[model samples]
Target: MKIYRRGVKLDLSIAVVVMFLLLLHMTGMMYKRELHQLFNEEVNISKRGFRRFRSSEIVDKEDETSKVPSEVAEGPAGTKTDHIPAYNMFHQRITKDAMYEPSAFYIFNLLDELATGEISNVSLFPGGSQIKFKIHFKNGNVAIAKPKRHDRGRYWAYDQSEPFWLDNERHNAEIASFHLDRILNFRRVPPCVGRIVNFRKEILPNTKDEEILSTLYINNGNFCFIGNCVPWFCNDNNPICSEGDFMEMSLCVLVYPSVEHPFQDRPFPWSQGIVESEIWKERNICTEMLVDPEITMGRFFLDLMDLAVFDHLIQNYDRHHFTIVVRFNVESFVVIVDNGKGFGNPWKDDTSFLAPIYQCCRIRNSTYQTLLDLSTDGSKLGNLLRLSLSQDPLAPVITEIFFATLERRLGQVLREIDKCIENYGNGEVLVDKVVVI
Candidate 1:
């Protein structure tokens, strides 16, 4: 109004004001946009995180490379998983020809005879550190050929007293494992011939070092009367049968085939029935029965061998040795032949895993020590175990297999039982003991 004629100062002031306003407006808009973006991104991010934590099927897949299935409840490393929930993980084997050896046909045939009650004294011979013996039916007609060191005159009876621990679970597991082993061995990915058959738990009475033995269910004890590979099948019809040619597998006759199974067994729906399948074994040999029965020899040195497997008579809660006998077509195989459980823990006992996993891991214990000192390398068992880790017989290559498998499956099992703390199980679950003589 004053006709200022637009002085330079005034013009400059106006320009400055305009610039200020423009700057303020731009800043405000940028602030609003930034706020909107931040809120939106936060909401989206939160939603993803929620689902990632909430759903395992979904979130777990995203982290597939990072997750491990829990074996024990709250593993030793403070892992959040409740391993117990995933208890007893078995890669179930539901087939007959798990082993497809030409030997299997004959092996199965001989086994069928026992299942149908054709023979008696089905004995499992010892291989390495295994010792499991069982008696099928009382062949009063048959004699106890391989009596233990103490048996003066104990004839074939279900109630014989011996030094081994026998039970339903051991027998059942052996049968089930045998099925697996025979099949794998058939393919020769691993040596099936050297597998420990039925499992026999041995209790040393006053000693802390109890023995867990597996057997081979020998057709005949490790001696030979014939050349080539042929086990003399035990036949009662021939009263003059010798433990010879040199030995035939102990035979068991299931005189009256049970309308139901003779042992504690669960058959998968598609299969006939499951005897023990040796899912994991020490060797990866073929699953052929001995073309030369003599090839199915017992462990060479008893004093050196550790655990016993495939023994016929486990007489704890129920009898699985009978099941083993039926498979080999034999009865009354050799066993420690005692009814007392070492720690009074039966096959079905809750703490059974601990016994094998923690209790039996000791290197100084007789069973463990025997295995150590007797090896060709004395300490080379580690080499064998390392070789076993590749595939097929996933683990459980030694007496420690049950121990290892249990310690693994029972990552939760150890939760309830604190026996390890009580005794410092110094048990090496995955690693082997270094036996320094």
Candidate 2:
């Protein structure tokens, strides 16, 4: 990958992995660039990189969790086993409009208020576990909901809000995702309002609800979060919605409209009443920038790569679907969202970046086409990113705040990797065992 960066020939890795990735990305790029290429998207993807902006530097595990008291780790958070539901079983037709329709049913099952946390506005839009819900509290606070774990290891809710992945790495990844989010915020990155969970122990399709929603979790750790998970691909009406034939567990976050809908919630007096009243939107994982409107130029081919890399620095695995809603008066404001996957590896370092999943400066078609569709004034893609690292308002959505956040984060990642390479220690089997085990 680095070789490709230096203008060298593509390596074996790029030939294999990048080629496959490009095949899929290009296919969409071609199509998106066609037909609706005139459409102007508003937001943009972070970035994709070799190791992304994560704290996933492999370290001496022996010195890791061991630092924390054994009892604290072994206590309730020690982790128990959790089961995930089958693919495409939760929401067969993941569409944005449909999420609101089935939400009523899921709300009933997910409003119990567990020991650690409680979600509100429970709405069950169909997905991976046949049940999805928006969790809210009477106090007006909310978190997305699914039947997460109970104190005694029981699944408190009745829907599939838990998560699709339940692996140990993923378990830790949850907190790492948040940690990464905070890390990014340290540099002023608004978290990508998204969610991330495990896929382990998921029941196959046709399984009984008792067996499906019945899946449990032993390690709740950071598996739980309070944000959207629909922006990526999960909430987008997929194969059932599109013409493709894809059936799998998808992670996502919703991207709601920026403007308010007074028809739903009337004008408010004091407080962020209106902003808070507006329902936020999100979606699932695309791993790369698809066709986002905020970005319409530069390596128009793969804008997602830039966003992915930006996310890497934040260590935000869940950026796939989250939000950063802001209020500027009765009707003026901006809200950034999406964080399905952030903070790559919780147990790693700020130096380590993944090769295949690394955030890079490649181009994808969706952004390219979307840019082609935008007027020069409305467009803000790669050129904007370059400006972001230096200026502001290359366009509205692409602000200098975002550029600094992204640039500093990238610098942090490079510095870490530089240290790792400089230190050059030989500890692979040890690191792998600690992470994968």
Candidate 3:
């Protein structure tokens, strides 16, 4: 009996040890899978071939050679070699304190006060459809203000009698674009807000009546303070013309903070040759044209990819040029400005505008993951945008259709990424680092 009991106890002990080892092995496998997902390798697809490297490996290799060559050696005649300066490609990441981060409410208040405050100086800008003014406020703030009355389809660009193109107005679009930029974590767009001001009181005295009449006109017997309308006789009985004090104009103005130094303008080197080409003119160029040489390829692609994603999200196809700001003469970053031409018509799905991402077949891992999360939970992103815009004192400029369009575009972007992953491994398709600087 004692021998049988010993045999049973021995078997039970052996079984327990085997189960413990099995659990440990499964845990280790799960951890390895997570690490693989987190640190996926990036593949650089170029005319030469596809080069794959881990993010850490790339950084280590670049660190070994502090300076990238400014120019490449001579190749066959007319053979183009990307000679972008390494400094231009790589920029140092900005710290929290060093960044010009501000709360939405704070910016809103500042813009509101500047729009309505007593103006010390008012001058016309050089170009654009509407009558834009550079205003200097009593508080020493400066801003560019574009009244809503003079917007497209409401007022003629050259003649007040002729209406501008439909849906050409940009003030509301400008405000909405800024709001979207903030939501996307792209802090490139400057702060803008909408405010209603009496044009006769705020602007008429400062400028010529002829200039004002040419830009601002009466429509439907009412003074169209900022946008276009059918020409109508302005009689004494006309409510807007009769009570001039009641003619309040809605204006979308962007305020500029005083920076120690102005941003340096540098044209994109790769685009210089193709700007006037038939392919560019027709907007049919592929992603291959954007590829830079290996020296600066890593950083250059990062900036280009981010910009491509951002433009697609807003449906802004007018990004021919961008500004690069050199901070402290060492670190630099690209500033995405002039985003007023966005969110034109919600009914149209312009997914072609995102050819860069779809064609390139790669994206930053963080951005890709965030996009997936947002895609799965539709209301989460919409609610976030609503909450942010609702905080603004101005009426909501983003419509329901527009929000739907945004979601549709986002899903399309994710589909493109998924396709890329299918073609190439996830490690090769999804990049880990977007900005080294």
Candidate 4:
């Protein structure tokens, strides 16, 4: 009894201090929630940076209330909380595809409306060899549309080593690539959806280009047109025709109306150039390219690794160039803008597509982990892709064989990463963060 009072007093004081700290933390969190609600009312997230909601997981015409707000709000410390939605929300879906942010879901709905949205203006979008149209929505939004050229069952007839330019830029591939981007939780590809438009009503009247107008003709009661000639097979009088005036196409949103956040295009290191040189494939260009002071210091190399994995999954070897968002002081984000060449061949898994991963022997830790998570026997990536694409108005986007091909390619990617890990330890192969100057 003489000294026991000392220990009891000490225990009491510690308990009181712990309780005070817990109360303070609770108050701080409550205040933050109140402030966030006041500023942004559209989104809701939990304390762990993930939100769980039980809305219609698949998009359809009936769900109008779930549309995502396009405007962004400034968060604490001036960061954009909704500019490009992070994977902060969870869907109640069966697969791990539930990881997409809420805004991503909203974008899908917006893209679906492209099929039926009232058209304001349409004109030829000149740049690449493929024919594309810049479509202006009556509501003031603009999109770049790639008309359907290949059938859903079109198989890859060319050899694996054939030049990528020979492949047709498929509209379904563009839409599928966007969904795959969301599935991989990359959020790099812009929002795209498959749209069926009438050439006579939606495109022909709106298009004033004499070159395009001259190419228009009716064949088998379907509206058809051969786009302006480019270096490839486009000028051979092969027209992209609609199935009786209705053509299925992919519409990609045109982000950044003004050039406030302009994009800077950089040529892919492994490209075969205009002449289709074998020099890039014959030797390991990454050996010399990796040593550059600028490449070694920035996040471009890391982005290339991601691109390699992405391209390999979809069997798209035409990554001749990539675009990065350029702005003051901030790190550049790679945008997988042109993906119409993907899904060209579900039968072939091009090893050259894995060059960036194999040669560099590096990959982002987040990407590696996500791929592993999706490749599990129970949670097959292809099955999840099928689930996600099922939401489109033009359902059955790709053949069932393509789903199996996706899983097969994912296994190949895993093997590549495993090889890199075996050659170099995890410390050397797995990058923790995207280091930017």
Each model's TM-score? 0.20, 0.25, 0.59, 0.74
Q: What is the C-alpha lDDT of each candidate?
A: 0.23, 0.25, 0.46, 0.64
Model 4 stretches with alpha carbons more than 4 Å out: 1-105, 160-163, 272-277, 328-330, 434-437
Q: Candidate 4 has what TM-score?
A: 0.74
Off by over 4 Å in 2: 1-132, 146-179, 186-294, 297-306, 313-412, 415-437
Which residue segments of model 1 deviate by more than 4 Å?
1-106, 117-348, 359-434
* Shift in Å, residue 130, candidate 2: 9.4
By summed lDDT, the worst window of 10 consecutive residues in model 2 runs over 238-247
Clashes of 1: 101
Q: Write the per-residue lDDT of candidate 2 for residues 46-162, one digit (tens) a residue.
A: 111111111112122122222222111111322321221111111222221122122222211111111111122334344432233433333222343233221112221212553
lDDT of 4 by residue, 1-437 (tens): 00000111223333333233223222444434543432232322112211111112222322232243332222233334343322111111112122223233334335534544567688878778888988876544568989888789986655655566687888889889987887677767766777677677767777788767887788889877777757464664668788886778788876544344556777778663554337666776777766675455456678778888888888775678866756411255567778888888778767877887887788889899989977875456786677556555566788888989988898999999999899988988898653332
Per-residue lDDT over 404-431 for candidate 3, one digit per residue giving the tens place of the 0 to 100 score: 6777778778888888899987887788
Candidate number of the best lDDT:
4
Question: Compared to the true structure, candidate 3 yields what TM-score?
Answer: 0.59
The local lDDT score (0 to 100) that residue 21 gets in candidate 4 is: 24
Q: 334, model 4: CA deviation in Å?
A: 1.2
Arranged by lDDT with the best first, the candidates are 4, 3, 2, 1
